[model samples]
Target: MGMIDQLLVIWGEPAAGNRQVIGHLARSAGEFRFWYEDDLAKAQARGFQMLPEFPVHRRADDPYIGRYLFALFAERIPAPTRRDSAEMMTAWGVDHPDDQFKVLARSGGIRATDRLELAEYRAVDDDLSRPLEFRIAGRRHITDAAPLAVEDAVSLRREPDNTADPAAVIVDRMGRKAGYVPRQYTQLLGGLVERGVPLQGKVVRELLLPDDVGKLVVRIVSSRL
Candidate 1:
């Protein structure tokens, strides 16, 4: 039976423009990372404020935000140790990473249309530093969540009928591109299931795409519902 699937992106700012919103999703595609600061900065400079979406933790003390950021970056790359995240944080100048962020900012990656000011970074080390491990916020367990619904999957694959913008269409077709917030995907999957959708065995995956678009895929695995 062709299930009535509905896919929804589980991360990022909803008002995140064409590239940020997650609707009925498809496969839980894996994860990927690319330079996004430019797009984000331009949007912020242009006055595009990140729209407080449904599930993004609102509290300033929310560890999920950090966890999610790390998870999004760490997944598939390799498991980073505590020392790794901390060391990378230290080398990147958690307090002044904007130096690097500016590189993305000038590249027109951050949406100049939005007024989203992201934290910038500076390199403290002389050699190219790479993130060796990844840790999710909230210590989110990756094995606990169900996959996207069958209906959501189908919708994400097909083009949206309402929007005429090709970029929007491309982003939507890309599935959920925003970096996932570690254990946050479970919350996202649960949120959709709670909405009366039948998503019992879905997992979030990643999709391959071009340079400008953030790529992510949501797959419906049969085992870990």
Candidate 2:
């Protein structure tokens, strides 16, 4: 509801199968803390591996803490010294491109070389008056789709049967399946839906990239807010 303080380190791609929540990276008491989720063993069985920089022995009870962002995530953000860094900063709505946490949250920390991605984690009890923006996930799997334009209205449908994520919220454009909402927001938005809160979504922007890997950003608003 205020400033985002945590992000879910997601592993794997939903389209490929067995997408899992690896862990959580949070800002606590003026320092950064990171820990693997309790069910890491289950994820490991499904092809998930502990990051080389973060060994599995480090449990949730005793997490890794540091004054700055962990190298595992810090490397994902583009360097502020890059020639196009300013352009990238503007694209991600980051006022200070060097602020690694903000950059990571806004950019999704996605890379083609790996299946790992970061998703802003929001508490279900947090205020919803402020509109939340997230990039539609699984867009690479959407086929035979018309291009989405900015300001286009979208629809959200709960997918209780979804194996990857039971709380998954499917984003639809004109009755066609576009993609699912990022995993991080599912619990919060899903909880709102369960309480019969009216939620609306609209396309705020779209980025058409190479290899048909287009991304769409949708802004969600709740009537209760």
Candidate 3:
């Protein structure tokens, strides 16, 4: 089975004249490539997502592409201090916001749209599979399919009696328990879910079973990779 490979980002402009960094994925994965479908004229408090690992560049390309790559992924770490270098790397998350981004990519053609907007958490919890009283609250491996293929939507179930964990439990759209949010992630991811930030999940690969689908590795991708 393939591991999850996608990331979400809160779409925000670094500052004036530094907008080029928007939608500019520094690196690429296998066959997929990501580029901003349009330009951002202003800061969008809204969150955005992309496959950071998708392969979009070639062996040879514009010098500018190579120049800005470091800024995009490293979040401007080791920022060049030179007066000239700093001016050039302005759009490369030069300010260096604490937020992180992850790359969730698929092997074949990318099914995600350019926007990659994360759906609201519990968006599908009340759908057809949902029961009136919500019986399967703490269940696991209950769905035959992944939450979302291209862009994913996962429901966060807080596990209280979760002898294993208490931070958070990842459930599929159908409310099947998928996995736990790593302890490190619970602070951010768990808080997001609690605050209603749509935690999107991407199913890069899965294990198929005769009677049912099994072991769906849905990677929760986000700006905080």
User: lDDT for every model?
Assistant: 0.26, 0.77, 0.35
Query: Where does candidate 2 clash, by residue pair?
Result: none
- Point out the worst 10-residue segment of candidate 3 by lDDT: 128-137
Q: Pick the candidate with the highest TM-score.
A: 2
* Cα deviation of 44, candidate 1, in Å: 4.6
Which 10 consecutive residues of model 2 have the lowest summed lDDT? 205-214
Per-residue lDDT tens digits for candidate 2, residues 1-225, read 357788888897435554678898999789998998877876776777778878855656899899988988988888768999898778776777666777887777877667787777777775567778888878666576545778899877788998756888888888887788877778887777777778788987664332336677798888665
Q: Under the 3 Å rule for N, CA and C atoms, how many clashes does model 1 have? A: 60
lDDT of 1 by residue, 1-225 (tens): 121112212223334332332211111123212222223454345344544432332321221222122332222221245446444434322333332322221121223233221211212221112211111111122233223332333111112242442212111213442223222133333333334443222223332222333223333222223
Worst 10 residues of 1 by lDDT: 126-135
Ranking by TM-score: 2, 3, 1
After superposition, candidate 2 runs with Cα above 4 Å error: 13-17, 140-147, 160-166, 207-212
Candidate 3 Cα deviation (angstroms), residue 162: 1.6
Clashes of each: 60, 0, 21
Among these predicted structures, which one has the highest lDDT?
A: 2
TM-score of each: 0.20, 0.84, 0.28
lDDT for 209 (candidate 1) = 22
